[model samples]
Target: MMKRKILVLKYSFLAILLILLNTFNVNGQDEFVKKSFTTADPLYTNLLKATEGNFKNYPHSFLENGNIKYYQIDEWTGGFWPGSLWYMYEYTKEEKWKKAATAWTNSLESNQYNTKHHDIGFMMYCSYGNALKFDDNPKYKEILIQSAKSLTQRYSPVVGSIQSWNTRKSKGDINLWEYAVIMDNMMNLELLFYASKVTNDPVYKNIAINHAAKTMQNHLRADYSSYHVVNYDPKSGKVLHKQTLQGFSDESTWARGQAWGIYGFTTVYRETKDKRFLKTAVKMANFFLDHPNLPKDKIPYWDFNVGQPGFKPDWDFDPKRFKETPRDASAAAITSSALLELSTYVKGKQKQKFYNAALAMLKSLSSDTYLNTNNANPYYLLKHSTGNLPSNREIDVPLIYADYYFLEALTRYEKSK
Candidate 1:
């Protein structure tokens, strides 16, 4: 009887093992790759698809109810969307993408879209600069001029800086934080400067210069790290406070914020030839690079303060978790591009250090484990990027900004080669 029982147990064990084997695609292989997924593969693919790949049946932007929303859908922007689309266009000389981009460019009137925020540079640099580069459509120039005018109109005579996230409903009282200057604001300064050139107006240039100078003085700390926001008294334009509202602390340097600082300061240096901006950029870059808390591969966390054991995350913590918390390769990709640009301005040994660091970031992003081209979502390069932190979600997924910098760096390197 004991022997009989042992035989039954053995057969049952074998049957369970067989069931387990068939239950999962434990060793499933991807359709187009010899290896497994990497973080950057899907990002790379998305960029290509936005431009090149079979976009014939491309679905228009989807609505919440899951309907197709095509271009010329009024609220949808075809102008800003073309920034990535143009990348593919540049590569393939494809006219279809250009046609799509033009639909949005033709849609504009006045300077309405020129938002009263730091993202103006982002909007115009991508949309208008693209139009200027490819089609040389003179109308695009007008659109850019109008956009800059709208942006310049927001400059506060009292604060001596542009107000971000403002709502007009405040009854002449500013609803948005008046003293706030994000690292991304570095991009906005260019629009003012660019507008200055277009309209032959020095006021716009002065606005840009003053805002940058004020930010440099108030936003940066003695440690070379920086804050994400600076609150100022709108009347006197004096700084009331500086803090990291978007990051781990008013004091903690968010990885992406630091990346923005690096990119923004470098751009400022290029446009204004400000040695102080250059010096500050280098200081922050060193702080980022020398931090021992970064992942072994050099990619950073969504928050630089991430990964510490005592760091109890909050309900609003959206610092790029992938099953477990992971590093933000998007930040790494952005910094890589910034470092590349910064190297051009730096000299001798400093130049080599920045360049090498940038290349290292790119190399780390290119590794198999980081990109995800092999799996179903095979195109995005960087991974674990957050779209918004308020909801505490989109953990470890591809973000549009990540793709932007990744492709830009790739293009820059490819063109150089």
Candidate 2:
């Protein structure tokens, strides 16, 4: 009887040990996340500390004059601040972030009905879409559906794509881009895809699919590098011209535009699980990763093909302009998130390459050069992001979307482990 009792106890001990081992094995991401939080926690705390009294205003981008520039509710980037708050809320599970997210997100309620252009995805999906993802509030869902409706108002069946921008207001805008369908616009389809799933309506999904298919066919160049904008004749749905408004030239690859393509197609794959989208995403990623001009740190210059041999901008556009070009941390953050997601869907060396590239980018962004925890800016993180460098606007400033995607990448990394 004594021997039997001892044997039972030994078996129980072994079972407990095995259970604990399984728990650790399943939570490798959590372990890395805990280590990361050691660095991230203070940055967020300092951010809240810096923005203590400034949360009322919606910060869009920073100015070189050392001031936080505010934007109206209708501004394309207005939702990113609130989206960042939601990500922080998700990471920390803190009440303050939740409260802040609610306040900022509610401020954009009127945007649900605004039909000026096709950025409701950036304006609503980044804000409310994340709100629903973390909290699953029905009100957020309704607002997203309404925003999707507003976005569809900009889609033209003739063009088979959503219109990106209206007529350019100034010389700073892209030349020959009147009725444009930009690569950046592909990022907006996430909102429509989500709306379709929630409402059980195929129209929204179909619109997103059509737009993506059209953009995939037209926007990408022969080498898989993307054009910034494709001007289409609104009347006949004909391609009028292709121009690179924000890139070095019409022929060069804008780093952020490439990042947008990777992110958008990866997202499309996520929503639809279509192998074609995944393949397209891989093609874009390969172009970006294997490009000769890509910085060794995995951060890319504002444009990759700026000064390659035989590369000349339109009309003596200064081929030497690539000297000391600025890095777009925003692109790095966006690409990191996309590659992390792509890693899960792929296997073998492709998966390893994608995961390693994302990890390297994340590490680079977390450094002091890019991660701004200093008191100079309290409401934002990550600096040196270039926005419209051609116009000399928001150069080397902290963009709100940069912070939004950085937090998202971190969240994805944590959950993946």
Best by TM-score: 2
Model 2 root-mean-square deviation: 5.1
Stretches off by above 4 angstroms in model 2 are 1-56, 169-176, 315-323, 373-376
Q: Candidate 1's C-alpha lDDT?
A: 0.63
The C-alpha RMSD of each candidate to the native structure, in angstroms, is: 13.7, 5.1
Worst 10-residue lDDT window for candidate 1 reads 28-37
Residue pairs whose backbone atoms clash in candidate 2:
29-417
Best by lDDT: 2
In candidate 2, what are the lDDT values of residues 365-387, reduced to their tens digit? 87767876454565467888898
1-417 in candidate 1: lDDT tens per residue? Answer: 999999999999999998887654332212111121233334434544554533222222323342333343122233345465565556556686676555444444433464535465665666677667778777777777777777777678777777765533221232346456566676677777777888888887888888777767877889778787776677787776665655655557778888878877887788789899899889989989988787767888777776465544333454353465556776887788888888888799998888878777766666556655444343443455653343344445665456567656655544543
